[model samples]
Target: MLVWERPEPPDRPVPAPLSRERIVQAAIRLADADGLDAVSLRKVAAELDVGPMRLYGYLATKEELLDLMVDAVHAEIRPTGDGWREVLLSLAETTRRAAHRHEWLADLLGGRPQLGPNTLTGGEAVLAAMGDVDLDVVVPAVSAVAAYVIGAVRREITERRAERESGMDQRQWQVTHGPYLLRLFATGRFPALAAVVHDGPHLDADQTFRTGLDFLLDGIGARISP
Candidate 1:
């Protein structure tokens, strides 16, 4: 009779129900709104009207959350079946654009490469694009091309962020810095750079990405065939 009351259920709090997909989507939204640094189990839980501990049901740790967020962004870039070269170029540019849009994406490493689905997907796409070429040459060649594209994109995104933060859009930078650049070039110390950057042209990232990809592939072909 003394034990029949069930101890009033111990007055425990009810844990908020959560799912992997839901948590991932919420984290994506959080990242989209406030960049990668804003996303955490506690932060997401506050947004989701739950406690931080609840996130463990879906994501084990903060690192896991970061991995999911990056992959989610990667999932947005769809590959159209053109040729291998075209597809790879498109993928490269697409990745660049996405990283540009979400500034934090360029820096998300997820500790290890394999844990991140998007990173793996992108790597696979590069391999697939080079599938037509000799594996030995094509693999290294595409790797170099991908590295260039990523480096360029990272630089571009960083510059863009700086411009946005400083209230100097591309137009303003060109208007203000164009003269100084020309003046410096007129000094002859940086003749080649000055000529390339004369009057400051905006880079067409898409065209640049494709052209570089082709150049690397051509080199690979030459090495393989010769």
Candidate 2:
């Protein structure tokens, strides 16, 4: 049975006034500071200055707490306008921004089907924007856009994390690696890759994301008639 299904003992003394919101916020704080692995019921309770058992009143399992955290962040995604394309773009950007604020969120992206209320509401906004689009393609289209957003954001986070660990910014990393790649290019083992390394622009995070997103959206648009 779910935690909510369990009833309080009639004679049990009432504990401190804690709520799910408070617990979830504490978990989010822990995650933001030390990454997702840092968040635990015990840690959250400590953060809240309460005993670990006190959290059981608000949440049952760690998975439920994680679900709540994901939903809480989903609440930040507010799609503007009624146009399906615009709404989708807004959703993607909003999600990216949220991930920026909560780097640990990258680990959870697309890892599960978040069924929390706020998550569903954000999804509803995407579908509602689709309007009269063919039902057959609506879900697929939404999935495609979401996949792109999640994948792109995750890549961005991974690269940034690598940069942080290596003590090198993007430009510095490029300069460090570029010479070795050029040497490999001279060997003619990877002509195609050589061409890219030699000719391709070293786009910053925003440029790389927007370029990929535009391409993804354009491909999706081809499937939508008119």
Give the top-scoring candidate (lDDT). 2
Q: Would you give me the overall lDDT of model 2?
A: 0.84
Query: lDDT tens string, model 1, 1-226?
Result: 1211112222224565566656788887888777878888988888878888766655567876776777778776655455565666666668777876777877762235543456567667666765567677766766666677667777776887788789998789889988988788789999779767765654575666666667876775578678
Pairs that clash in candidate 1 = none
Q: Scored by CA lDDT, what does every candidate get?
A: 0.69, 0.84
Root-mean-square deviation (CA) per prediction? 8.2, 2.7
Error of 1 at 204 (Å): 3.2
Error (Å) of candidate 1 at residue 136 is: 1.6
How many residue pairs in model 1 have overlapping backbones? Answer: 0
lDDT for residue 67 in candidate 2, whole number 0-100: 81
Alpha-carbon deviation at 37 in model 1, angstroms: 1.6
Task: Give the CA lDDT, 0 to 100, for residue 134 in model 1.
Answer: 66
Q: Which tens-of-lDDT digit does each residue in 1-226 have in candidate 2? A: 5443455333323454567777899999999988988999999989978899878766778998888898899888877676888888898899999999999888988976887778888888889989898988888888988899999889888988888899999789778988888888899999998888768797878888888888877877888855
Worst 10 residues of 1 by lDDT: 1-10
